[model samples]
Target: MTGERRRLRFRRFATRLERALDGGGAVRRRRRPGVCAALDRCGLSAYYVPAEYGGELTDYTELHQALRMVARRDPGVALAHGRTFHAVAPVWVSDDAVAAHRVGRLVVGGTRIASSLAVPGMGPEPHTGVSAYPVVGGYRVDGEEWVGDDLAPGSYVSLLSRTSPVATPRAHSLLLLRPDSLPGRGGPSGSRRLAFCDTRVGADALVGGEGRGAEIVLKARQLGWAAGSALPLGAAEHALRERLAGSRPPQTRRFAEAYADLLLCEALSLVAVRSVHLLPGELSVTSAVVGLLVPELTGAAALAEDAHLCREVLAAQFRSLVRGHRSPHDHRPQLDRLFGAAEAVVPFAPERIGLFSRHGSAVLGTLPLSVRRLRHLARAAPEFGVAAGHAERLLEVTDTLHQRLPGPAVTGDPGLGRGYALCFAGAVCAGLWLGGGPAVGDGPDGLWRDGLWLEACLTRVLAHLGVRPPSGADGALFDRLATVMIRQYEDGRPFSLLPFPMAEGEPR
Candidate 1:
């Protein structure tokens, strides 16, 4: 299908899903089933499966967009439904044909697979609660695992179990088992707990291999961190909308700062998601930056309501950032494609994703060039002067940050990590603005025009990094962004960089 046609179909599907969700009401208890059914009716499950495995998941960005759309309305529901995609990540990365096909068949048949892989912030280590001892036929499993919150009798659970007695990275193994095959009971927060009391399965249950679980799960979590960046973005977008509503609104500066933060989040997430395909090896740093910043920014807006989720997400990013290796690599072409919103991305290739980045973040490292390009544009158009100035400030702070950054083994400073993430976000905004090509006659409307949004975002990033702008300068940028935001709100559009039209009849 043509890109336009596919986008149209997705928009239609999004509209239908929104209508279904709107009919479900605000009660969380009643909303879960409705959300799942709505998503199923819209054929979202198919996107969770790989194209080679009889599904339409040709690109990670497509799945990210779908998840973001769902999350805009309900983050919890989005996370719940996103588990299916998360569950299949290890299967895809492992490249085990049998496991892939089996999981694919289940997913294609609309079965929700629950994964027990340690959450992102929980480190790449397998859950210590579960262990599988080698038995005659298959491993004898014994332990407790927290599966999906709303799993049913026939649902499948992907368990990460310790396979070796020794404490080693390769000691864990992944298994796909049915809930009915094991004894499970109710757990907290509506989750199902699998109590495997010497349960045995055939060798076919082992995913990837006996000692490859850690590698598979690590890669899968990286994918999760990159893709799940959308969740917080959507939630922040919702918060901005709420802030704009009602007779009395917050101060314009506050609302505008919130909007700028959301734009920054989107910029980072856009690059991170596309990196999964274009620059997978470098994704370690990029995804970690995204994972750290999204929640931090969104949590400040009170959008990331789930504190536990934020903690896990932050913890994961912290570990990845501290362990990531930094080597310079040429990724200019990839960066161009990543920033170009209309560009078609390459297919998802999980094999390219590495546990540690051999090359550091191309986005952050390329900041100087992006700023130089912005300055050059300013020289020609004059309208880009303000944005160029902000970009230069961002460059100064980034250079300072580089000097303070420790080597891969030593740095665990949260402040330095946050500084790096902010710089990365600033770089993305500059790259995206420049990627749009030289602005002609003051640029297009909304955020793009006059580089207004870019300047605001840069200013916000600088402030986060402790570089306060000149007096009155910050307020002016905030006022401009707030005006644009109010316009979007009045026009029934989402408060995003793209500002796509919200589903018709969507509830406030």
Candidate 2:
């Protein structure tokens, strides 16, 4: 599907899915069959499969947008439906004709695939998740894989197991297994708590080649992290649409800041997704930027809402933020590794390789528009004196950060990675504002020109850098955002990159 077609199709699906789950009742309940049928009918399942395999996933941008749409309505359905692609990504990159063809057939046939990549004994240790012993025709597999209820009849799992005696992280290989084909020791196959015991597979089941598990896992994770940002983006929209419906001062401020934060994240995700296509080599750093900033943005939005609502708001946001993982901390180790890698890969002087510097024209093409943005923002600064010169100062910092980059030879410091990502986000946001780009979805006025939201965004970077905000900065910015947010909510629209129109008589 073309970009416009994907958006139109997914929007149609989201509308129907929302109505079905809402059931015209006060409480909205999600049923697997209803969700699957809706999605299947719309050919959403094809997004998971590659085009050559009869699916429509041409790039990460489409996947991100599609997942964001589902995530806005039902997180559980989004994750369950999307995780299969996470597992299949490694296979897709492997370029193994046979394996790709097989997976493609299953995906086109509407069969769900699960992953057993992260099993017990998976660390760099003597213990291995599953061992592949040499046999006549192929390697016999022996181990256990714990998984949730994602598996069922006709479903398969992509398993990573130890194939060589080295017993190291790099010594393993990947296998796409059929659970029913293996003899199960115990546990219900249909239950979410099922653990496959003594699972075995032949040589042809191997994903690409022997001892490629470590490399494959890393690539797959990068793809997953890049796509994962959609969940938070959608969740933020969900929370804003549901919780901020009043015209009161506090509610209005929270809504404005929330919307600004959403823009930063939305831009960050788009840049990262495009990088995968335009600069796959830099994905190591770009994906890390996405992984770290997404959680940061989600938490920030939740915090803003928490200040206005009760603990329930925070709890719901938390659940939406960390729904598919083992725990919130699950992303920490991966984050650390990615960050460490980023310091080496991220150019301090990004003009040579920066997305905004090189690719900004593709997204925002008018210099006149950019100048108007700066003027509008400049005009609004008088009202919130606390953020005076902050936007310009941030632009200056962006230049300095790029010039100061120590080059790719130095080992990356995780702390430096955080600062770099913030600097990158600030640069992109400021540049877009300067160009007077339109908001994700709004009227002729460039949304970023709102003095209040820009100040809030600049203040956030300053706070992160340990700079104290001017007196009344907090209160002034909050009140400013609150007004905008309230107006948007009253209009009955989602605070999204491209805002969705609400149905007639849709419940708030």
Candidate 3:
């Protein structure tokens, strides 16, 4: 399909999905069959398959937007259905054409696949309790596995199994097998316990070469971390909207601060997703930052409303960061393509994805240049002065962070990690605003006009870093943000940088 037509297709699907869940009570209590049927009918699985395998996925940005659209209404449904994409990610990353074609065709044909791969913000270790012993024709699979909540009798299960007795990264391997092929009984919470008493299968079931499971799974998890950030972001948007709708809405300060947090989350998510295609090698750090910060910001939003659930969520974000971080290598990213919303992304190549970033973080490393550009823009357009000032503050914060950050030999400092994440977020906002992505509009009332959104975003970042601005300055910035948010709500637009058209009709 043409680019315009493809975008239209996604928009239509989003509208259809919204209509499908109308009046469906609480999302967690809703029937899975009905939701799955709606998702399948809308061809959600097609986006999980690569284009070379007769699927429609070309850009991670489109998929990210679609997931966020789904998540805005119901995060539970988004996770339930989006797991299909998560299950297939490893196959794509393995770069095994045969396995890719097979899984891709099955996914395209409306087949659901369940996997044991942990979701983003969850730890990266797969359930390795299952063991696969090598045999004459193939491996003799044995042991119980904990699959996802959506597994079915005839559907396929992708698992990471121990191939050797030694406990090492290279001792495990991935296998894609049919549930029916193994002798197992259904377990509680939609998991399966495989009692594979000498069950045998052809060697073709292995996803990649033996002992390569850790590498492939790591890369796949990086992709998941970047894409999965949309879930909380959408939920946060839902919370902000609900707050605005109440009879006695929150003060302008509360609304604006929450809205700014959501925007910063989106900025980080957008850059991380695009890096999967443009800077796959640098994804290790980029994805970790997203996995860490999105939840913290969302949790803070929840905390403002006295929701205690965010405490657990914040813990998960920190755990995910500790598990995912590694020493950085160096490689420059395609800044033009990375920040330009209209630019076409190159096709995804799994081989290009590295286990760890060759360079630390392209987004954070380029902060100096971004600050310089913002200063130049400030000179050219006096209205940009606020954004430039914030950019300069960000540069100062990041430079100090770099000097104080512990050497590679010592890692896992919570304060240092959070500081780095906030700095990266600041850089993303600066780069995106400077690049004039689609999120930045030229209309008289646009959020980017006079760098209003950027100034608010940077101010929020600085506050998070304990670098407080003038006492009342934040209130004024937040008040302005609240006004823009109300305007978007009245016009029935999503609270996003991109102006996606919401489902037509009265606001929900």
Candidate 4:
């Protein structure tokens, strides 16, 4: 389905989900029992399956849109459903029939899934306390596993554990285990540990072969990077709606900045999802960039706090979506240490940057050609105006970073990574806005006004990178865009690439 149709479908569900939350923003713990029924009733559970498994895996773009919409109302619901997709992504990629069937059955049956992976940076000890030993028939597992608090009973949980005694870094494997398969009781626990023991499973329980845990988990992580990032993007969009609803002038500029940032993120996220879909193996760096930068830019926690949403609930949802996932933020030292040991690598190529692929260059030789063509088009197109300038400057900065990035001793500084993310986002916004021509919205000079928004984002990125631009920049552009955004929000339209109608219920 097209993204527009997907948004419409999600809008219908959003109404139901909005009613389900009843303005609290998440299903209460004591009310967890009926949550799956609510989700199943809305047909949200089908998204958990891939098309091959007889579920709605139309495309990443649609799934991303749906998740973002669901997140706007209840972030926890989106996190749970999205994380289940992460758990089963490896199964789909592995093409293991048994595992695929198992996952399909669960989704069709409206069962939730949980993921349990050893936390990165945890010392040699497995934080999950889950260990699988080879046994007759299959493997036996005995340890307490970590699971989401809202996971319903009889849910299928994916667990990663060490399968080899003489362990190297990659000795772990993935197992699809059930609470009933294990001889212990499993349910929501105050301690957050699902205690299991002497769980003997048949060989069919293994999703991926022995010692494939790292690969399987990495696949899941890559799939999750964009989906996980969308959670915060959705939250920020909702917060912008709430903040702009007040129609306060003093905060208009800030809201405009936030709206611009959110739009840029939407573009970057679209690029990231495309990257994962096309070049799955080479996305390690791209996924890290997205995972680290989306939440940082969206400021979901800060947005929640600012919107007066429940802090504790937001924190818990973030922990489930963001903290449990690995990104450049978690492995900065690892990258620094590894790159420090390697010999000097290849210099930066413009095509090597993610933006080049976003433009649809079919071959390496077409990259520079594509860039030249875009520049020529921008020059000829008066509508591009300032946004084209932002894109050009972005190429220069990306070139500088790429040239220096391949060398040894490059510090994996997260702030610098965030700066690069902003740079990329600015480039994407500029390119997309120019290519999309004038936006259909409230402003008289919508395209020109949006060009200023692009400039503002580039200004923030350049400042973060310590690159000074021509001075005398004013907030006038920001104020104008903010006015447009506030009007858009108050008019019952969403602040997004596609303006879908907001929930008809009264704002919190």
Worst 10 residues of 4 by lDDT: 333-342
Instruction: Name the 10 consecutive residues with the lowest summed lDDT in model 2.
Output: 341-350
Lowest summed lDDT window (length 10), candidate 3: 303-312
lDDT for residue 469 in candidate 4, whole number 0-100 = 57
RMSD of each predicted structure = 3.8, 10.6, 5.1, 10.1
Per-residue accuracy of model 2 over 312-387 as CA lDDT, tens digit each = 1112222222222222332221121121111112211111231112121111112123334565655766553434
Model 1 residue pairs with clashes: 121-316
Per-residue alpha-carbon lDDT of candidate 4 for residues 467-490, written as tens digits (9 for 90 to 100): 755654546656766766766566
TM-score of every candidate relative to the true structure: 0.88, 0.71, 0.87, 0.75
Clashing pairs in 2: 149-192, 252-482, 253-481, 253-482, 348-402, 349-402, 369-435, 370-434, 370-435, 440-497
Candidate 1 C-alpha RMSD relative to the actual structure: 3.8
Error of 4 at 7 (Å): 9.1
Candidate 3: tens digits of C-alpha lDDT, residues 1-508: 6778877877787677667656355444667677767777777778778889878788788778777777777766777787788788999999789999999999998887888632222234334667887898899877666776456756887778888878666777888888665544323233545445566767988998898776777678778778878878878887777778883666678778888889888888988898888988777677777877887897633312211212222223332333222323143555877887556677787788875554456666667788898889889989778778878988887777666554452243566767877988999988887775454575324777778888888988988999887767557667778888888776667887766545743233
Go through the candidates in order and give the clash count of each. Answer: 1, 10, 4, 0
Which candidate has the highest TM-score of all?
A: 1
Candidate order by decreasing TM-score? 1, 3, 4, 2
The C-alpha lDDT values of all candidates are 0.72, 0.56, 0.72, 0.56
lDDT tens per residue, model 1, 190-255: 456667776777788899998888778767776777888888887777667776774376578877
TM-score of 1: 0.88
